[model samples]
Target: MPSLPLRAALVLMLVWPFLAQAQPALKVALFEVAPYAQKEGGALHGLYIDLVRGLGAGAGFKTEIALMPFARVPLALERSEADLTISFSTEALEGAAQALGPVALVDSVLITSLARSTRELPQLKGALVGRARGGCQDLAQRAELALRWTDISNFDSALRMLALGRLDGLCLTRDVLHHYSALASIERSRLGAEILVGQRPALLYVRRGLAPEVIAKLRVALARRSPVKAD
Candidate 1:
């Protein structure tokens, strides 16, 4: 028979495997992002939602979804309301969110009112353009567009301004404009969605101190996906 200390050590060693095997659920935060992550009848659907679930499978984690406003995802992670976020701009990652890498999940676009002949970023040179505040920095930077700019509060405001002819053009993501414009009676022909050449970099933010194996499994899965490309 071993001493009490040795017996305690052996008991801990025996229980650790069972404790580790009983993995905690991974809480993933998301918002209403159409064609990418949309919640209907309490279920998530789209490429990103699928991707996260797939990665979770690889990591042996059961994912629990938490739906919130787009702006609150990071805050959810901060408060431990979630263990991860669906996807967000890597540049915006701060606090407890640690970026894994860029996800080439969607295309960026330049939206123009029907009347304007702004076919692309270059054509909008010298025209007044509105960008969603803190959105599409990569597009602007990559395009090297030289235009008068304003920071609008959200895409809805920018879309309204465009309809009223307050702004000549706006930069936004494809599905975002696609989903929201239809809500406002804006036709696709009325709004030109020129898919930008460069890809928008999306990142998966995990809560700090999450099991490294989880992140590693995600990295492996991401690597196995289609390579990022211009649309």
Candidate 2:
């Protein structure tokens, strides 16, 4: 039993939601990996993408994600070619890059096909290791492996090389083995990976020279949630 003015006010209140605008443009970069960054049917989808989308929505911004090979990700950041990059190990945050928040803590491990011979760290001498370019997981220990490094651009290729026994080991986050193998129809039971090193904290890195306010907003958005997905 509201009066005419009250009825009109209530109608306006309900309509205000429809009149609201969409989020503003916020450019984001994503590498080809899953449950983190994966592209299918001309659209980006994954856990990290979801987490960023949540942040963008919560912070009032629209996301413009660019999918690229993992190796090319840091190069894009080094050249200030991207506004933001999906999470990566802090060790790779070189050049003018600055980390925003810890997005995930994943077990970065070395994987090999079960058929291939497994070796301990000391036994890795003279062994061939495959890893993504621009990655710095165990670059410091490369000399210990006699430094036979083969930079790969795609996960399936690296796994394929391992299955073919062409590479002694391929190091990456363990989730890559679980998700990418399912996508590529490679059986996971046929492979094994060990934590060649300790867990790594993955964080989003923004190239220097970006607006401080934008970086601050992103940091606050992520810090509030911690976005800590243990993968």
Candidate 3:
């Protein structure tokens, strides 16, 4: 018969694999970008929220989502305070985060103040334009505008600042503006004209140094949730 300690050691060796296979619970930081992510009736809902939950389920992971300010998401990822975040763009992607998969959820628009009395699209050169700190993607090449950019934490703040004449215009997704128009107390008619500035893909970002298997599972889950469209 095996000694008592030998038997105990064998039992632990068998049990440890099972424990390791158990799904890990992760904290996912979500931002209130509207239509993409937001809180409603004390629960989170939106395209990105649904996609994230579906991905987590497929990957055998349990997730708890907390709404966070947009600008703080990068810091959270860098600090390992949040395991996952969503809706990040190419321009915003940093070395501290690992991007999993892409989702086509945003098309940007540029909105200017009606109070400025400029009917035509104002030349952005030398203008004080407001943009959400981590929300804008693919806009860095517009260096010719010499834009006085103000980076706010969220869409609502940018809208409010523009309405109050603190900004000449705001650059963001039209869907986001429509989602928070009522909450921002800005009339839709007063938003003046909007310029379509092209669309870009958004992706889920996780803290760097995650296991490759975990990243693979996340990519498979996202692919199942939002299949890549043919060009």
- Find the candidate with the highest lDDT and give its number: 3
Residues 145-178, candidate 2, lDDT per residue (tens digit)? 5846788878877787787777887777778767
Residue ranges of candidate 1 with Cα displaced over 4 Å: 1-22, 88-90, 94-96, 114-116, 120-133, 140-160, 192-197, 227-231
Q: Tell me the lDDT of model 3 at 153.
A: 71
Estimate, for each residue in 1-231, the C-alpha lDDT of model 1 and write its tens digit.
899999999999999999877878899987655666778887778667876787677667788876666667777777778888756463444665887776555677777766665456666767677765445666556445666778765567678878777888877777777777876767556554454644566676788777788778777876776634323
Is 1 or 3 the stronger prediction by lDDT? 3
For each of the candidates, give the backbone clash count.
0, 0, 0
Q: In candidate 1, how many Å is residue 190 off?
A: 3.0
Colliding residue pairs in candidate 1: none
Q: Rate the local accuracy (lDDT) of all candidates.
A: 0.70, 0.72, 0.73
Give each model a TM-score.
0.72, 0.79, 0.80
Candidate 2 accuracy as TM-score: 0.79
Which wins on TM-score, candidate 1 or candidate 3? 3
lDDT of 3: 0.73
Q: lDDT of model 1 at residue 179? A: 70
